[model samples]
Target: MEWRWNAVFLVSFGVVWAAMTTAKPVSSLDPADAETRMLAALEDQYAHDPGNAVLARSLAETYLDLGRPGLAIAALRAGDPANLENPMVAHRLAQAYEASGRVLDAYATADLALARCARALGTADAPSGTPVPRFACDARQHMALSTHQEALGHMLEWGIADPARDARTEVAYDLALRRASIASAR
Candidate 1:
């Protein structure tokens, strides 16, 4: 039993030592160089697994962080269309579209995301009766509303005069107001 215990300890110590020695220290690299390295690694992984939605999203986010919204759009498009149903993917794609001077596309994409959120939460249309304050506090609904608001802001900033955009903006504003009212009531 003593020998067996000693052997186990030695093996665990060796593994830990090997890991500590082999791991690269992140603090040693310059911020820009580290970002470039991370981007290259993610790109390589993406190239090997082109259909990976998570990888595609990561690459898109990295490109966005680097101020390359066009590249971000390309990265997002490289993945499966089904991935767009993911709120994060839709939000990022909308941002990329807006940054690339496609305000209408951004608005449409955001609207689609909001619709998805509503469908997922089974709140496509509010109840016809008295409103429940708790309904306004849903996190998913807040995310959808915020994304829609952002898209509307971009459209308004671009001076695009469209009734659809105006209506969506008003809806987002109302949702936010309701959320505030609910919070204050609590």
Candidate 2:
């Protein structure tokens, strides 16, 4: 039921990601050379600031853009514990795992990312007219929720029941998905 809506969201998200990745910028330099330069810069930046969540995320994204999910996974994993717990990093790591054909790992990581997002956003509901968080929390939460739903769908498809499943989580996720859908439609 809810999973059907989740499936639609996941497929749309994947299509957007694929389209974005495939769209090359019109540049005087060769596209490959530009991407290579961007990758080199990201690697250097990440090397200097391994604990920086933003750098780690950027490095992982670059690796993924270059179709090297293995490198992306390594980049995401080789960071500070606090940084590694970042929802965005976890989201990217899950994507990397999926790209590399590691379905179980991807599902686990997406679940973790969803948990991290819930923690970051807190349990207390915001007032109806409250301003959105300043740190891109909305986008982070959306990414985490969509990825987890997608991964959970995959697990069910594979006949695996997640041992971590709970009724509370399912209800919360459904509400969150509804809110996200409403927000996006605005």
Candidate 3:
């Protein structure tokens, strides 16, 4: 038992040390180069350990920087529910949908993901243990909302924000209004 405890302590200390010094950082808008490479390494680890749902989710997130929605979707697909997919996979799916020019599908998926986050918010893990807050825990809600909102913005800005003043004016206006509404509510 003594030897086992020492081994565990040593391993835990090593992990903590690495995490403190070498672990990658995350941000909502921009990530540093070191962070990017760390994400890539994490993705590779997920690929090696296919059964780790948390790893799968992380791998999907990391690939977002690579502008590879398809691969991100692939990784998130492998993630399990519970703590993994309920939210992120949905958002990434929306990204993939949008990239594929499936605007309606993209909106639908993003909505569902945000809804899931909303549903999970402050509920299961509330301080007072009250019912779920009907939205995400605080950070989670904002993150979900941000991703969906950003996706909508991207959809609007995808084609230079240039509109066809001729026949497609109505279509352009509709899209612009939708994006504007989403952004304003942000």
Position 24, candidate 1: lDDT: 90
Clashes of 2: 0
Candidate 3, which ten residues in sequence have the lowest lDDT sum? 160-169
Compute each candidate's TM-score over C-alphas.
0.57, 0.58, 0.45
Score residue 43 of candidate 1 by CA lDDT.
90
Provide the global lDDT of candidate 1 against the true structure.
Answer: 0.67
Query: Could you tell me how far off, in angstroms, the CA of residue 61 lies in candidate 3 after the best superposition?
Result: 2.8
What is candidate 2's CA lDDT for residue 166? 40
Tens-digit lDDT track for model 1 on 1-186? Answer: 999999999999999999999999855436578777888899999888876767877888888777689889987887777667665677779778866767777778776665555555556443334323212225545555554655465555646655343555456446556665675577
- Candidate 2 lDDT over residue span 1-186, tens digit each: 999999999999999999999997754346368666877787888888888889888888877876789989988777776675677787888878866767678778877666556555654533334333323345546555564656455454555534234444355446656766676778
Model 2 stretches astray by more than 4 angstroms: 1-32, 123-136, 159-186
Instruction: List model 3 lDDT by residue over 119-151, tens digit each.
Output: 566434223433343323356454555556454
Greater TM-score among 1 and 2 belongs to 2
Runs of candidate 1 with Cα error greater than 4 angstroms are 1-32, 126-145, 149-186
Screening candidate 1 with a backbone cut-off below 3 angstroms (N, C-alpha, C), the clashing residue pairs are none
